[model samples]
Target: MRILMGIFVLAIYGGITFYLGWNLRTWLLAIQQFRWPIAYWIGLYAISFGYFIGKLHPLLTPFSIVGSYWMFFLQYGLILCVIANLLIAFTPLTTKLVGTWVISVLIVLLIVGTYFAYSPVIRNATIEIDKPGEDMRVVVASDFHLGVLSGKGHLEKFVQLSNEKNPDLVLLPGDIVDDSPKRFINKGMGDVMQQLQATYGVYGVPGNHEYYGNEMKQFREAMEKANVQILMDETILVGERFYLTGREDLTNKNRLPLSKLKPEDNALPWFVMNHTPNDLDEPANLGVDFHVSGHTHKGQMWPNHLITERIFELDYGQRGKNDMHALVSSGFGFWGPPTRIGSRSELWVIDIQFAK
Candidate 1:
C-alpha cells in the first residue's frame, strides 16, 4: 500500500509537470535562439530547489526569494495555463490560434495571480463566548512565511495592522517564519515584531514549516527576540479568564494528545491556537470556546483551496459546533509566486466579546 501510494504521488506530480511543460514548450522554443533550452529547464528546477539550500545556511538567504518565485512561476503559472487551455484543446482550432490563446491565458493568469499574491486581504470576524468577564479582542495572524519571499516589508505591515486594531491579544497560529530563522531575524523581523502592541500579549505556535526547515532553536530564538511567546503543548491563563491552549504541530509525533495538553479545569473558556485545522472534532468536543489556527493558507492559491477544504473541518473562515468556535485564516503572506487567485491573503481579526 505504501509503495502504491508513493507511485500514485509520483504519477500525479509527473503528470502535472508534464502538462505544465507542454504549455511552456512554446515559450521555450521562442527563446531557443538563446541556445540554452536544456540549461534553462535545468536551471528552473535548480532555482526552485535553491530555497532549501538557503534554509540550510544563513548566508544563502538571498537566493531563497529568487527560488521561491521560480518555484511558483513554474508550478502555479503553468498549472493555471494548462487548465485554461484544456477546453480549447479538444476544439477544432489551427495551431496558430491555439498557441496565441494559450499564451494569452497564461500571461493573464500570471499577472493576476501575482497581484493577489502581493496584496493581502484582511478578514474580520466577531464571536461571543459565555465566559463571565470583560470583552477580549484577539487578532490572529498566521503563515506569514517571513524569511525570503516575505521580508521586512511584509512583517512591518502585519505588525502595524495588528497593533492598529488594538486587540487585547495577538495570536500567531503558525508558520510565522518561512524557513531560515537567521535570515528572518537579520532582515529585521525581530525588530518589526517588537513594534506589535497588544493589551495582553502576542502568542504563537509552531507549524510544520518550523519543523520542516529543521531550525527549531533558531525559530525559538527569533520569537524570543520578538517577544512573542511560542507555546508548545501547553495552556496558559490570560486576562484571568481565558485559558489559551496551544498545541504542538501534528508534525511532532510525540506531541501530547489534546486530552493531555488541555486545561485541567475545562470550566474556564478556552482559546485554542492550533496550526492546521484538522481533526477538530476532538478539540471542539473538549469545550474550547474559540479555536484559532492557520496553515492551510486557504489553498494559498486556487483549486488547491479545494483540496484543503476537503481535508480540514474548517478550511477558511469561521465554523461552530456544539459550543466551540473555530476560525482558520487563509494567512497574511503569500507562500509562493507572490500571488493569490481564488483565495485572499488574510489576517483574521476576531472580536471575542465576553457575555454576562
Candidate 2:
C-alpha cells in the first residue's frame, strides 16, 4: 500500500515538472527579443535534477543512507543557484543568458559561504512555571530531523548549544530522527544521544516521521542510551511542585484517558508535551497548566509560514486558554531543500519559578 502511494506521488511530481518545462519554453519564445542564454537553460536543468535526486534518494536503502547528507548540501546549492537565476532573469538590465547563469552560480556560492560561516547560534527563551521556591529551566528543541538531512555534527552542535543554556530539563517535541537510526549505524545516533546533558533529564515523544519509518523502538533505545526519557501517555512529578506529562502523537490516538489524573491533584503546575498541537481544546478540560510542541518549523521558509499560521492556532509562539499556556517552537532543523529562507533553527528555554 505504501509502495503504491509512493509511485502515485512520483508520477504526479513528474507530470508537474514536465508541464512546467513545456510552458516555460513557450513563455521564453514569446519574449523572443531577449536572447535567453544557453547557460541559463543548462543551470536550470542542473538545479531541477539536483532537487529531484535530493527528494527521491532516501527511498532507495543503502544509497539513501549514504547519500542523505550529500543530498542536503546539493539541494541547498541548487536552490541558491535557482534563486540567483530568477533574480537575474527579472532584473531590468539586459544581459546574455550566460551572464545570468554566472551570476546565479555566484549567488549559490555566496549562500553556501554565508551559511557555513555564520549559521546563527540557537536562540533561547524562558517561561516561568507556577512552582514555588523551586524553579525548573527547560530547554526545548524540535524538528532536529537527525537522519540524512542533518548528521552527527549537527546533533553535536545542538547538544553544545543546549548545554550552554544549562537547562534543568530538555524537551524534544518530535522529528528528532528524520527516518530511521538503523539507516546510518556508523553515524552513531546512539553516541549522539549519550552526549546530551541535563540535570532533571531529557524527555521526548514520537513525531509523524518516527511513525512513518516504523523506527520508534530504535529511536527510544537511542534516547535511552543518551539517558533521555521517552514519555508516552505518562506523567512525572518534578520537585514536588509540578507534573510533566507527555502524550503520544495526538493524531494517532484520539480521546486519551484523563481519568488517571484527578482534579484534586492540581497541587503543582502541569506541563504537557505532544508532537503536534491538535488537542489544545481537550487538554484545557484536563486541567493542564501548559503545553509545548513543534511540528511547524514556522514553514522553514517564506510563504509556507503563512500557510502554517492559517492552519494552526498556536503555530510558532505562545498562547493560552483556561489557565493553560501553550508554546510551539519553530524547530531546530530543516526538512526539504536544506535551506531556511526565513525562520532560523530555534532552542527554547523555559523558566519555571515557584510561587511562595
**In lDDT terms, which candidate is top?**
1
Q: The CA-based lDDT of model 2 is what?
A: 0.68
Error of 2 at 88 (Å): 12
Error of 1 at 242 (Å): 1.6
Could you give candidate 2's per-residue lDDT for residues 230-328 as a string of tens digits?
A: 887778886565677877775566626654643357777887888887657777777787789999988775557898888888788777777677889
lDDT tens digits, residue span 1-356, model 1? 99999899868755665566655675445545334667866765556566666556667756666766666666556655655576557777544456556667766876887777667767788888877778777888889888666778888778777778888899999988875586687777788899889888999999988998788998988899899999999889987777887889999999988888677875678888899788778887878788888888888767788899789878888988788888888888867567777877678788877777
**Per-model TM values vs. the true structure:** 0.87, 0.75
Which residue runs of candidate 2 sit more than 4 Å off their true CA positions?
A: 1-12, 19-120, 131-133, 183-185, 254-264
**Local distance difference test values of all predictions, in order:** 0.78, 0.68
- Minimum summed lDDT over a 10-residue window in model 2 is located at 62-71
Clash count in backbone of candidate 1: 4
Clashing pairs in 2: 37-97, 127-350, 127-351, 129-352, 131-354, 131-355, 132-354, 132-355
